[model samples]
Target: MSARTTLRARWQRLAEPTLVRRSVVSVLLAFVLVWGVLLCYIFMTYKHTITNDPGLQKYGDALLVSLQDVTNPAHAAAAIDSTETWTYIRRRQIGIFPGKTLHALSDADGNPVFASHELKTLNLPPRHPEAVGVITEAIAEGTVYRIYTGHNARWALQVFEPKRTDAAFLAYNGRFILPYLLLAMPFVLVPVWLSVRNGLKPLQQLASRIARRNNDDLQPVGFDAQHRELKPLEQSLDTLLARMRQKVERERAFVQDAAHEIRTPLAVITAQAHVMARSQSEAERTQAQAHLEQAIARTSHLAQQLLDLAALDEAQRPTPRDLDVAQWLRAALAQAAPRAMARQIELSLDAPDSLTTRLDLPALESVVHNLLDNAVRYSLAGGTVAVGLRVDDGGTTLQLAVQDDGPGIPAAEQGKVFERFYRGPGHAASSGSHNDAGHATNGSGLGLAIVRQAALRMGGQVRLGQGLGGRGVGFFVEIPLAARRG
Candidate 1:
């Protein structure tokens, strides 16, 4: 597809319930609602008007009586058309009996009345068959007939108003009604538009603000809105901005610190290499070589820290694999065994045979390794570091906790430990005084930060507290349980 066509399609997809659709649907719904109410009002008004019209009801009843009197066989047929008799009735009853016709009846005693032969084509008897049927039914039911019957011989009375001459009355109704409907249409349109515009104002403002934002605009969105519904949206957007700002700031600080750290080690290596070049004694050469090795180790440690940070950032979803949490923790403990031995810390594992948590193995392994590594590094010789696993509520998660019997963190500082490059006072103390060249080292202090990030990516949480015996810090990681393997 052409670029323009593609763009149009994308916009069309996004524009469902657009301004046009909203306005149209709103107006149509308003029209229907108004029309329905008008219909009900007209119906009620017409019923009431008809009921209250004393002249119309009185005249109609008189006309029906005249027609009934004419239908009787006892009143012998005059040579004159019954239409002439109707004239007398109509003038007397305010034109109610305009005119009528007569048909011979089935019963010798009864005659039929109608205005035209067209009406007789319906094959209705002298009286309506339905009316006669009702009288017969009443007699069978042992109920009194409310309709005129018995001596009247079941003659029917049907009334009709002339459509041509009465057109003026209908025209008069429209004359009063049409102008009102037209005038009220604009009034309805204005309010519906205004209410919708008012309702969408905050969203419009939000869109405008977002559209105007540049990459450098990290300021939080202000909440000077008058609407209550908009307040939640404003607060949520501000929260998102605050989080994004913190992430950017952390990344920037990490870069600056990493550069400074790498530069120092390189400076040390360069200075040592220059000294080794000028040295003439065996002792000087040995000292220079040892300094160079320390610089190389520091550079390697910095590189590892950078790698861990990237891994944590990249972690979003876990690969589909059955990860045994207990087994992974055991493997991590075994890897940290040497470090724990050097620190004279006891590595204790308390796990089920095949406890599993749903996660990517590599990312999950990093979480386990980092926590245990930190625990062993900080603990005093002969102190115990324990790792344990248990299932959570709903049987849907595996909770892993690593505890060390070293100096515990103060409650006030527990929250800050998870921040990147933040190290507890206990770890800093033992880091500088250790004996083994590789084992004594502390890299960029991102171990706990990595653990927290990994936990978040795995849909888990990391909490810090005192150890099982309240001796040192406890690092807890909780993850959802894996699916059953077939």
Candidate 2:
């Protein structure tokens, strides 16, 4: 492919769900996290202003005291007009009061002091008899007070700050700060964003390096992340790559080993066939033919095992369906019947009248066939091999078992039996007959391995032990009933 095409493909791969999910989650979390911190800072400033304003509190208190002295007319008027308190009052008034008008209650005659505009709007009784009661109670309660009222209503104290001035102050601040803020934002955002992007540069480089790799290249990821925070992530990715590389190497080795094993039998068969054709004596020809047949059988068995391994390696999940366990067990018995008869071994079925299970057809077939073959192949001639199928625990468990009169495996070696290519200790002694003529040895090991893989794929387990009816090996499989489907 062209370089441009390869680059495009790499970009597409980077758009995979894993990368997209990580990027979106990181950005969203960062936004919420930063905004949350800023909001907390603003809340702290608000609390400090309201709580620590001693000067403002004192002014409010003095205003309340003045409002309480209503009996002395001269003192009340002087208090109302007192220039000594004007600085305190104006500033406090500007800070606390938002409306265009406020009210002052005189202690002398219960009169009100207000602006001219307020007076024109509110022509009330000499004493604002309506406010006298409310203001008296409010002052007595010592609440740093504010009241909301219309222009036509009489109030205790009235102060007005021009709306134009308030608007101008806000507009002036906004105008003065806007250019600088606009200019500073790029500086702030650019550096932080660049720093963040730069910090993430190693990740991008690592991705690019990974992208450049061929399908067969599962080598460790190569990148020197500069930041401490990125090191752990790089290390994890490196570990993952190492594991993947090791798995690929193991699979390659297995394929090579299988090919070598198969090739030997095929070469022997070819040689034996050539010898049979050239043999002049009937006896020699017959022996050569027999050897050729054995070699062909071994080759065929090896081929079958390779195919089974390939099938078992497929990652696709099986489509499970409910099946009658008794019926399936009967079928499994029928499959084993031929091998049993060849050895004159009696095969018997002990399935209940009706039982059901959830299973994938092909996978379940492999499981049954392998277990039955293992049982019949290992059993002594004239031995009885019994198959059983039943439901237990209100149909939650569908159990299938096959038992044969053969030497059982040791308990300690049971775990190792499931491993690929693992041959039991007494496999040679257990073979019982050289009539094993046209069959496989390695095939036995592969059969059990395939059985385990299939059982696990169907969310089930298989176990080996002494038979329920005999002192020989019993192969049993269990699948959860819930997986069953109509």
Question: Can you give the TM-score per candidate against the true fold?
Answer: 0.66, 0.59
lDDT of 1 at 325: 68
lDDT by residue for model 2 (321-407), tens: 778767777877887788889989898888777665566777888788877776677677888888877767666777877777665
Which segments of candidate 1 are over 4 A away from where they belong? 1-21, 33-64, 68-183, 198-214, 272-293, 319-321, 339-345, 380-383, 392-397, 405-416, 423-441, 459-486
- In candidate 1 the C-alpha lDDT for residue 147 amounts to 26
Across 1-486, the per-residue lDDT of candidate 1 in tens digits comes to 999999999998978676645785778676657655765576567656644653333443554445454544344233123543664576557533223322232223344423444344433323444543232211112222122121233343332222212344444554556677768877877777777777887799898988899987778986577888888888888899998898789789988877876787889899999889999988998999999998898789768867977977973565757666677777778888988788778888887788754567766877887787677766677888888887866787768888877766767667677776654454453542111122323455677777888887777888876685767778888876556331
Backbone Cα, N, C clashes tallied per candidate = 2, 12
Scored by TM-score, the top model is 1
